[model samples]
Target: MSTTAEAPSSSSENPKKDTEENSESRLYQLVKNLTILERRESSLLELSKKRESFPQLAPVLWYSFGTIAGLLQELVAIYPSLSPPTLTAHASNRVCNALALLQCVASHPETRTPFLNAHIPLFLYPFLNTVSKTRPFEYLRLTSLGVIGALVKMDDPEVINFLLTTEIIPLCLRIMETGSELSKTVATFILQKVLLDDFGLQYICHTAERFYAVSTVLSNMVNALIEQPSARLLKHIVRCYLRLSDNPRAREALRQHLPVALQNGTFSKVLEEDPSTRRWLSSLLYALGGEQYNVGSNI
Candidate 1:
């Protein structure tokens, strides 16, 4: 009876061991394929997304393996094609996949600091700076922003400071001014995050030229919204204005140049269901409440 019982237990153990070995084999294939000269970017993206389900995956891919370096290598291999804008859709899609993996690394707390320390994000600036409206280039720009956006989404002030040292603001401002609505919204969200940081707010308000640059993009965004009217985009735009209001100089400027549409109720119906945005709009007005002023070209 004891021998018979042990036999069934051994059979169960065999399948569990086999399953573990199979999983490990698969992971090894994914990692090793990363070193291939013609690597599969889509495979990297799949593994990166899997990190969401397995909390330890990103750290392991980032630290114990060559995931970040592999992705960067894959990205740089295609960098030379951007200047004259000869990048094909196939190439853009491949690089974007690699970017998705890099974004995963940027977002994970354990790997985020080192990712910044290496200045890995600088590799992506060209993509962000691209003016191509072509779908391939647009997708590339948006994916690259995802990496930067992940970095800023963290609560660390260092992330904001590091980005400030770079030309992140100008690049984002350009995207805010010209990218598609979805891209514009993402760029605005990044700016909004930076402004929420005390140092970021001070930095923008530190110079009139800088302040004017920001306020102008915001004004243009508001003008566009008046005609097209995107509630989601408006939400981010309002949050940016509300955060800027925390700065005294910025607050006064806003009061003097707050968009007429905002004060005159163009979005009253738009915000009917968005209580949080409505509250933010109200608070923005109150922050600038001491006086009512006219909207003009000065912003």
Candidate 2:
């Protein structure tokens, strides 16, 4: 016969160890759920190629992906300790959804106005700022720029100012200076949006002489545009320079490049033909020399 041992009394024992174990288990399960969601999202992306073949399915798929993205964003926001890698991964996926939506809306002008009216400066702003700072995961930067490209079409001055004041200009400049071809292309799109604003123009003027290093970046973007002849990228760079050189000092700094840009003819023609581009050029030329250059006529 063995002596009976009393079970540990709950009131006499520490419950902290059990609580900690429970917490760890809960965290593990949450992480596992998130990982599964992410894998499912990745699998969905592989179906994009088939989307074109089944045109009717594209919008439904985009909506589904977008819903998943929204859920992921909400979950990550709730779980602050979910890890940067996880947040970045989810953000990148959401950005892809946003970009696909943007392209869809862009191709159909009727859809564009409503989409921008609904989302600009609200969903897109924080999303851009979030992805812009995600290091070691620079692909997000490209996607952020795509969002910016879509938002730039909005005729909202406040939105434009927000982008410039948030240090997006310098960030895009850095990426344009150092990133790969595709990255630079996207950065240029975002930079174009910032440069369309008055604050962006002032920033460039203030920093113009101090950062001659940026000249090389500008040159590289120009050369790339020349090589690829991407109308979108070319239009963006021209618009950026037009806003940037709006100040007298900045105009002088950019004077060296003006002749070259003008000689290219495509940029100048676009500026002349496009109402928005024309407005910026007029403002820039007026700032530089007080409306004496006949710039408006060319525009």
Candidate 3:
């Protein structure tokens, strides 16, 4: 009787073990294809671009359990590897695809405010903060900037206020200082959008310290482009300075401290073909004080 009872007990445990194994198999089956991530990003990118077609995308994905949270889980799971900076391209691409999804949410007006309310952008800072020069990290930083880029591109004051309350300005400035040319352009664009807003303009110009911080970065980028020129980047730099000149105090500061490169033919070669950028340069020079500053600009 003892042996019979023992055999029945052992058999019962085997079925439970098999069921657990089956559950594990089910999960692997569910998550097996990394392409699922890629496909989702592609879909969301289309949704962001043509949101009118998929009008209900915002609510469905925003409220879905595994949508944003699932995307974040992908990031948080890889958080450890970022410290020693061991994050791989495969992993970075995966997480960045998820980030691209976040960008979709951020771009959609319906989701942008709530996305900020929930502090979704905060989770991306670490990726932006990583100091690695490797392509993986650079791509991560650029994609991360794209999310912020989407927000500012809307020219919303509430978005700027949310950014001002956070460390976004400093973070973007750091990227402006250390990121790639494309990255710098995006970083500068965010700053430009912020400064374009009436409140953002006042807030940044409220203190001399803040004013100099942004001016210094724009000045540095102009200097760098003197050697390795990017017409796209220069366009935004000129626009940023032009916007800054809107503030009386900032305009006075620029009259004295604006980079000499802008006043001369330093970028004459690059601007020769970029009429729109040349126009921006003209507007910036005109705003600085007088048309005399446009002497050698060749704009």
**Candidates' TM-scores?**
0.90, 0.47, 0.81
The residue ranges of model 3 lying beyond 4 angstroms of the native Cα positions read 1-56, 291-298
lDDT of 3 by residue, 52-134 (tens): 44444555567655667767877787789889999898888877767766787888888899999999998988887888889
Which 10-residue window of candidate 1 scores lowest in summed lDDT?
290-299
Relative to the true structure, candidate 3 reaches a TM of 0.81
Candidate 3 residue pairs in clash (backbone atoms < 3 Å): none
Q: Encode model 2's per-residue lDDT on 184-209: one tens digit a residue.
A: 76777666665566665556566646
Q: For candidate 1, what is the total of clashing residue pairs? A: 0
Candidate order by decreasing TM-score: 1, 3, 2
Please say which candidate is ahead in TM-score: 1 or 2: 1
lDDT tens string, model 1, 1-299? Answer: 35543445545557878986776676667766776656566466566656455455557667756656778887887778888888899898888878877887789899899889999999999899899899998999999999999999996899999999997999999999999999999999999999999999999999999999999999999999988999999999999999999998988898788787777778878888788888888778767873452222111
lDDT of 1: 0.83
Candidate number of the best TM-score: 1
